[model samples]
Structure formats: structure tokens, C-alpha cells
Target: MQCRLVVNGFLSSSKFSEIYAWLKAAFEKRGHDMTVCTNIELAFEKTAVTEPILFWDKDVTLAKGLEAMGLRLFNSSRAIEYCDNKALTYIALKDKVPMPTTIPAPMTYRNIGYTHTEFVKKAGDLLGYPFVIKECFGSFGQQVYLAKEPSQAMSIVKNTREPLVFQKFIAESQGKDIRINVVGGKAQAAMLRRNEKDFRANITIGGKMEKYTPSAEEINIAEYVCDILGLDFGGVDLLIGSSGPLVCEVNSNAHFKNIYDCTNINIADKIAEHIEKCMDI
Candidate 1:
């Protein structure tokens, strides 16, 4: 099998570089010739799209271009776009999966910002204080915020100039969450993440991780999310709610190193094998 692992214009960080290395090695070990291609290297003049693509970037334009040339994208361009936007992810999986009450932030121009923030008041009224505010496109828990009071919530709204969301905060799941890696509509590896101080339980945000076995409900949520999103592989984040597991978010190109370190499970291997089967290698 010959394929190209497509990435963004930049590698972003060492974490992403490490993930690319692991994925490349995993496929190569399975007797496949994997070439790394950045979005910068894409050329429209090229023909012969014989090899499948393992797209690891969120550049929808590049992904779409590749697809237009008849190259198969592992998770598909639509899948990446759906998962890239937090509000869209909720909208797409609203009835399909259990999740916190989410309200998409009103549209705003980047220059003018949220000139009419009266909607913030409405969101505060509906979601209440201590609600979760997340920038629509963020990862590793960096753009997530907790507003403990209306003042704090309003302040967040006033400060943020990007698309965002107001969500019901699950207190029981504060500082704790579950990450389940799903490949080919199946849950492959799971981990529990907890932080004593922060509300976000992302390992990148100082959370502790431990290997975990997901319940049937949890597994269903994880697999269903991937299946519905048309993802070949994904990392599903779940909040342990009082009633059941509520989805926190989904990562199309989730970094598997943390899960590997915690569970000694190489999700890259699972992904490689799944891709092989998908492309019929």
C-alpha cells in the first residue's frame, strides 16, 4: 500500500510531530509505504490519485482539493470540518448522542466583535452561572473556560472575539472526564482523566490519566459519535454525568501519545490496521 499522510502547513508542535512519527512508523511496519505531505506541498496539476490519504490537518480547503482529485481521505473532509467546529459538532450529534445543553454564540464580525452582547445575558439566564464557555475551534482544553458568576460569564463574552458556545456545566464531572479512542466504529482504548484543580480534565492541562474500561453506554457513545461523523478514527471525550455519560467533544486527529502512555495501547496501530482494511490493502 502506498499513501500520503497529509498535515498542515506547519507541524504546530512537538506533540504533533511525535504523532506523525508514530503513525508513519505504524503503517510502515504493516508493509505500507507512507509519505508525509504538508498542505504546502499540494499541487493541483498532479494526477494519478492512486494512494489513500491520512489527513491530519484541519485545512478544509486543502482536504477538499485532495478529494476533488479523487484521493480518499481517511476521515473525509466533511468529517474534519464537522469536528473542527465545537458548535457544529453538537448540532450534528445533538439527538444522536447525549451532551450538555449547548447554545451557539451569535454571529459576529471579527473587527466589531460582539457589539450586541445582550445575548450573553440571555445565555447566562438560561445556562446559569458557572456555565462552560468554549471557543468554537480549540483543542487540548486550551480555549475552554468556566464562568463561576454572571460577571465572569459576561466578562468572558466581552473578551472573546471568536465564535463560541455556552453550555451547561456538569459539576459532577468537573476536573474529570473520559477519553475513548474509536477506530472503524469500535472503541479501541479508553482512559480516565482527572485534575484536582482545573475544571478541564485534559491531559495537556495538567490532568492525570489512568487506563480505564468504558461501560457499554460509554462505548456506545464513543462509537456512535465516530460512526455518525464519518470518522475513520477519533478520540471521544465524555463527561460522566449524574444520569449517564454526556459527550464533551470529539477529536478527529486526536493525539494518541497520552493514551498510549497511560494504557500501553498504540492507537496508531489500530488506526493503521483500520486504514488498511478500509483501503483493502
Candidate 2:
């Protein structure tokens, strides 16, 4: 099958190159007509006739524009919309299985107010220190902060786009989180990221990763989370909380090589296989 794997950002970017190399080598080995390009430099006029396009982690705005121009996305446009928002995904799936806590932005300080702590300056008495303050729309470990006080949490909300969520800290979580790579509604690989010194659990930010096996419940939660969010393929972050497996976030265009090394699975190949399975060559 002819495939066009589109990626945002520069090819030299570590995150971009990591996935690109795997995809390039894998698809070429399979003899699929493949092309890769940055979002802005992509000349859709030429590619439209030769291949099927799959955009990586681009904002849905571009997808909408592409659709209007008669371009197609590997994942349906509607699914992309739902997967982009972490809060929405959490709200949608919280009832089905264990899910993270998130408080939306643009509210009074009193409604989502703060306190003081020596360990966590300007802390929020409610959410408490080490609680999470995530930007309404951020990915790749960016725009996520740990607030010990209400003031820090307030800053995160006041500085970012309206409607943010204050996630209650999972202290017993042991400064770690699990990310499951799922494709075609199946869990392919799992990695545990931990940084006891810091609050966040993303590998890019000084966190360590180790192979992990998800229990039946965690796997079920992984499948259910993505299925509910309408994700085609994504990295779902889960926490092994006291309750069970609690999903933290769903990354639509997840970076896979780091995960591949940790899990020893050729996720790029699986992605190609998935494409071949869903498409009529």
C-alpha cells in the first residue's frame, strides 16, 4: 500500500527523527510507496495522487483544512478531535474505569483556591502540593507543572488558555507512571517512567523507563480508554493507583522508538501493518 507518513516539526528534531527513521526503514523494507514531510513544507498538491496520508500529532485545525482541500487522514477527523483534549477524554472515560482527576481553568481563585507550605511554596490547600497543573492543550511533557501551593496552580491557570484542570496528586504513585502503546485497539508495549525527585513522570524530563506488564485490569482500562476516546493509535499513560489502573492522558501521535527500545517491539512495523490491514492495497 502507498503511504505518506506526515510529521510536524523538523526532521532533525530528536523526537521527530526517532519515529521517522523507524517508519522510513520499515515501510521501505515492505516496498510501500512512502513519503515523509513537515507540515508547512508538505506539498499536498503532488502527494494527493500517489499515497494515503497519516498526520502525526498535528493540531486538528490542519486536518480540517486538509479535508477541505480534499485530503484524507488515516484516522477519521472526528476521532482526532476527541483525542486532542485530555480533559475531555478523562471526563468521557472516568465512569467506565479508573481515570485521572482534572480541574478546568478560568475560574475564581476561591473556587479553586491555595495555601502555604515550606516544601511547596504558595500551595493550594485543596489540591495540595505536588498536585498537577496541565495546560489545556499540551503534549510531550510540556506545559505540565507540579504545584505545591494554590498560588502556583493559579499561575498555571492564569497564564494558559481558558479552562484548565487541577489534577489531584497521586502521592502514593511513587513518582512514576505507565505508558501503554496501543494500535488497532490492542496493547503493543508498556513502559514505566519514574522520577522520584520530581512530580512528573514523562521520560523526556529526567525520568527513567523500565519494561512493565499490565494486569488484565490495566490492559482492559487501556483498551477501554482509547476505544472511548476514538484513538486509532496512541500512547495511553496509566497510573497503578490504589483503586486500580487510572488513565492520565492519551497521546494521539505518540513517539514510539524510545518505547520500542524499552519494550523491544517494532511499533513502527505494527503501525505499517495496521495501515495495510485497514487499507485496500
Off by over 4 Å in 1: 43-49
Runs with alpha carbons beyond 4 Å of true place in candidate 2:
9-12, 42-50, 68-72, 107-130, 159-163
> TM-score of predicted model 2?
0.84
Instruction: Highest lDDT: give the candidate number.
Output: 1
- Candidate 1's TM-score: 0.97
* Clashes within 3 Å, all models in order: 0, 15
Tens-digit lDDT track for model 2 on 26-96?
88888887877667666455445446677774657666666666766766555677666656766677777
lDDT of 1 by residue, 97-118 (tens): 9999999998898898887777
